[model samples]
Target: MKLTSALLLIFIAVHALIADGTVEGKLSVDLMKPSPSRPGYLPSPTKHPVLKPESAPAIVYLERDDGQYPRLKTNETAQIRQSGYQFHPSMVAIQTGAKVNFPNLDDEFHNVFSCSKAKHFDLGRFRKEEISSDVLFNKPGVVKIYCEIHQHMRCFVVVLDTPWFVKTDPEGKFSMKNIPAGDYWLRIFQPSERRIQERVTVMEGQTNTLNFTR
Candidate 1:
C-alpha cells in the first residue's frame, strides 16, 4: 500500500509539471543610430525624449519580444486601435490562426491593410464607433500594416506560430505562463521596424527572465 501511494503521488506531480511553464524577460533599447529616414534629428519628448547630442542612434527603445510555449493551440485575440491618424500599440504579436480586431477611434474614416508576406487584408474605410474587422493570420512572420489613404500611417502585425507570447512593456518587462517545461526559440518583432530572435528554456516549476538588445 505504501509503494502504491508513493507511485500515485509521483504521477500526479509529473502531470502538474508537464502542464505549465513560464518565461519572463526584459528588452531594452541600445540606441545605435538616429532614425536616418527622418531628417532634422529633432529633440522633442514626443519623438525623442532623451536626446544624446553625442549619442549615436545605434540603440534606442530596447524591448523584449517573448513567446512562451512553442507547440500549443493558437486561438487568441488582439486589438489594434486607430487613433491620432496612426495605429496605437504599433507593434502587436498574435498566434497564427488568431483573430485581430481593429477598432477605429478617429473621427474621420480610415482604411487599414497589410501587403506584407505574413498576412494581407483590407479593412476598408471604417467609421468611428462603427469600427470592426477580423483577420486570421495564416502565416508566421513580420506583417507590415498601413493605411491606404494615409501614406505615413503604418503598423505591424507579428503573426507567430505559437500561442504563448507577450510583448514587453515600455520598461521592457514581459511575463508568460502555462508553458510545459521544454525549450523554445524566442523571437521579437518591432512594428515597421525589425525582428529579434533568441532561444530559451523552461524547466519544471521554474520562471526565467531574459534580456534583449538592438
Candidate 2:
C-alpha cells in the first residue's frame, strides 16, 4: 500500500508540471491615415502611399501575480532595418537583455539614437557599407528610436522582462500558447496610446480568450 501511494503521488506531480494554457485575443483601434512617402536621396520613379493603424502593432504579455518567472535566455538578436528613409516594421517587442541590430539598407547615412529612460545611446551616422554595432536592451521599458538626420524616421522598441509576450497582427489578432496554468496580470502596450491591464486566471489544459478596443 505504501509503494502504491508513492507512485500515485509521483504521477500527480508529473501531470501538474505538464499543465499549460493558451491565451488569444484581438485589438481594435482607430485607423491611421497613410503617410506620404518623402523623396529619398535615391528616390524611385513612382511613390506609393503607406497605410498604418494608429498606435498599432501592440504588445500583449502575461505576468504572474506572485512575480515568479524564469529568466529569459538571450541567444538570438532581432533586426530593425533602415530603408527608404524609414524604419521597417516601426514597432517591435523583445525580452529584456536581448540585442537588436539596425542595418542601414539606404544609400544615405542614418544615425540611430534614443532618449528613453530605459536606454540611452547614440550610434553615429553610418551608411549601408558601415553598419552600426548591435544595441543591447537590458532594461524593461519603452525605448523610442529616431534618426538624427531624418525627422520622419522613427521606431519603438518595447523591452519586457516576461517571456510570455507576443505582438498583435496587422489585423489586431494575437495568440499565445503553452503558458503555465496560473493566475496572472495581462497587459498591453501600444505607441501613442494608454496602457491597458486586467486580471486573468488560466486553467490547466484550457484556453482563455480576451479582447480590447481603443
Candidate 3:
C-alpha cells in the first residue's frame, strides 16, 4: 500500500508540472550592406573611397494591454550610470512596480528625467556613488530616459505588465519558464532591426523556440 501511494503522488506531481509551459528563442539584427569580394577579403575603402549608407533595423513585440498575468509578477532592480556622459546598457526591460536605481558613477553630478506619457519624473543632480532616486513603473509602455545636462545621453526603459518578458542577450537569446499553458502573441524588437510578430501556443512541459532576423 505504501508503494502504491508513493507512485500516485509522483504521477500527480508530474501532472502539475505539465500544466505550466515555457518559451525560448533568439533575436538578432542584420545590417544590409554591400558584400566584400572573397571570404575575409574586402576592397580597401581608403583605396576605393566608395560611399556606404547604413540603416538601423528593429523589432517590437505586440501584446494586449488588458490587466492579466497577476501571478506573473517580478521584482527587479536596475541602474543608469553617469559614465562617459551617458547611460550604460542603453536599453533595459523591467516589470511594473519594479524599483530602478539611478546611481551616479561619474565625477560629475547627473540628472535623470523621463517625460514619456507612460512615466514622467525627474531626479535632480546627484553626485558620484550616490543614488539619485528610485522609480516604480506603474504602467506598461516605453519610457525615454535622458539627462538634463547632456543632450546626447539617452536610454530606453520598457515597462512590462508581465514579468515573463525578457530582453535578448548578447547572442539575442531569451527564455521564460513556468508559464501557464495558453495562447499568446509573441513579438521581437530591435532598436534598428526589423520587427516581427507571431502567434504562440504554450503546451504542458514543452518549449517553444523562435528565431528572427532583420
Candidate 4:
C-alpha cells in the first residue's frame, strides 16, 4: 500500500508539471503616430514623428474566443500622469471595465478627451495635483488619449477581455509564463487600431517562442 501511494503521488506531480506551459516571442512591431488632431483644444502640430517600438512598446496578449474572463471587482486604478507636457506610459492595456485614474502632475491645466469607439470621455481641465473621476472602460477596444491644452499630448488605453497581457520590451521581446497547457491566440495592439494575432500552443515545462512581424 505504501508503494502504491508513492507511485500515485509521483503520477500526480508529473501530471501537474505537464499541465503548465509558457509562451515567449520577439515582436516585430510597426508603431504608428498618436492622434494629431484636437480641434479647438490645441493647435495642430506642423510635424508628427511616427513612434518606434523602443519608444512605445507593443502590448501582446492572449485572447479568449468567448470575449469574457473573470475580472476583478476591486477599485484599483491605473494611472496616466500629466507631467512635462506629456502623458506617462503612452500606451496602456488593461482588462475590460477597469478604471483609469488620470492625475495631473504638471503645474498647468490639461483637458483630457477621447473619441475612440471603446469609450468617449472628456475630463475638463485637470489642474496641478488634481485628478479626475475614474475613466471606466466597459468595452474592449483601443482608446486614444489626448490633451486639449497640448495638441501633441497623446497616448492610448487598450481595454481587453483577458488579463493575460504584457507589453514588449524596448528590444521587442515578450514572454508569458504559467499558462495551462492549451491552445491560444497571441495578439498585440499598437499605434492605434492596428493589431496582429496568431495561433499558438502551450506545453508543459517548455517555452514556446513565437515571433511575428507587421
Candidate 5:
C-alpha cells in the first residue's frame, strides 16, 4: 500500500506540471485607411504607398486581474535592426524585462531614442561598426522608438507583464500554448486602432478560441 501511494503521488505531480491550456485566435482589421492622426504625433513614413489589411500587425496577450504572474526569464534577445534608413520590422512584442538589441546595418550613424512613459532612453549616435548595447524593457506599455538623425525612422516596442503573449502574423493569426488554466483578461494592441480587452477562461488540457474584429 505504501508503494502504491507513492506512485500515485508522483503521477499527480507530473499531471499538474502538464496541466496547461492553449489560446488561439485571428484578428481582422482594415488597414487600407490611414490611421487617425493624433496631436503631437508625427506619422512615420513607410516604404510602401498602399497598405493591405494585414499590413498592420497586432499584439495579443493575457493578463491576470490581480496583476500577478509568474516571472519568466529568457536568454534570448529580441532584435530590431536599422537598415535602409529605417527600422526593419517596425513592431516587436516582448515580455517585461526582456532585452532588445538595436543593431545598425547602415553605414551612416543612427540615434535611437524614445520619450515614451513606459521606457525612456537614448542609445547615443552609433554606426554599423560601432553598434550600441542592448536595451532592457522593464515596464509594461508601449515604447515608441525614433531616430534623431532620420525623421522617418520609427519603431515600437510593446512590453507586456505576462509571458503569454504573441504577435499576429501577416494573416492576423496568433496562437499561445502551455498557459496555465485560469481566468485572464485577453487583450490586443494595434498601432492604428484602439486597444481591446475581454475576459476569457482557459481549461486544463483544452484549447480556447477567441476572435477580434475591427
Candidate 6:
C-alpha cells in the first residue's frame, strides 16, 4: 500500500526532527493455559513440540493519538477465507474503516456472521469461491465472527485506531520503530488471552524495552 509506505516515510521525517525512540517488547503467556481466548482448553499437539505453547504470536501496538495515521483508512482489503473448513487466519488486527472480504472457498456452503459489540451483520450462505460480502470495520474493538452452520468455524477481527502495530513472532517478541517521542500505552492483544498494557516513554535513537511474564 503506497499510502502506508508514505505514512512511514512521513513518520520518519518527523522522528528525525524529534528525539523519537524505538519500542521493542515481548509478551509472555502462562504455560499452563497457553491460549485462553478460544472456546476451551485443548492440549498442545505434542508435549515437547519444537515451539512451546506460550510462544504463540500476538498483536502489539501503541495506544496514542499522533497527528494522523494512514492505516486507519485503506483501499487494500483483508481476507478471511473458509478453506479446508477453517479460517485462514483465525485472528487478525486491522485499523478502523477497513473492509474485510469473507470468501467461501470450500465446496460446502458457509454463512459468516458476527455478534461482537464492535459491529454485527449476517451474510447468508454462499457457494464455494463466492464472496458473500465485504464487511466494513468502522468501529474499533474485537469482532468475533462465526459460521451459522459450522459452529466450530470462528474468526477474530481486531479493529484498531493506531497504525503502529505488528504481530509478534513465535517467540512472543515484537518491535516498533519511527514512533514520535512521547509517552504511550503499549497494548498487546493475544487470542484467548486478556489484552496487556504498559506505559512507556519513547526517546529518539534509543531502543526501549518492555516485557511481560506470569
| Top lDDT hit | 5
Q: Model 1, stretches more than 4 Å misplaced?
A: 1-14, 17-19, 29-75
Every candidate's lDDT: 0.64, 0.79, 0.67, 0.79, 0.80, 0.74
The TM-score ranking, best first, is: 5, 4, 2, 6, 3, 1
Q: What is the lDDT of residue 60 in candidate 1?
A: 17
Error of 4 at 125 (Å): 0.7
Q: In candidate 4, what are the lDDT values of residues 73-120, reduced to their tens digit?
A: 456478988777778888888888789998987667789999999999
Q: Higher-lDDT candidate among 2 and 3? A: 2
Question: What residue runs in model 5 are displaced by over 4 Å at the alpha carbon?
Answer: 1-18, 29-56
RMSD in Å for model 3: 10.1
lDDT for model 6, on a 0 to 1 scale?
A: 0.74
Query: What lDDT is reached at residue 123 by model 1?
Result: 88
Error of 2 at 109 (Å): 0.6
Report residue 183 deviation for candidate 1 (angstroms).
2.0
Score residue 150 of candidate 1 by CA lDDT: 54
lDDT (10s digit) by residue, model 6, range 74-190: 575789877766676777788888889988776677789998999998999898887467889899998988877666567678888888788777777889887777778898877
lDDT of 1 by residue, 120-195 (tens): 7898988787946678887877777777655556666766667666766656677777666666766655432555
Task: Return the candidate ranking by lDDT, descending.
Answer: 5, 2, 4, 6, 3, 1
lDDT for 213 (candidate 3): 53
What TM value does model 3 have?
0.73
Clashing pairs in 4: none
How does residue 112 of candidate 1 score in lDDT?
88
TM-score of each: 0.68, 0.80, 0.73, 0.80, 0.80, 0.76
**Model 5 TM-score?**
0.80
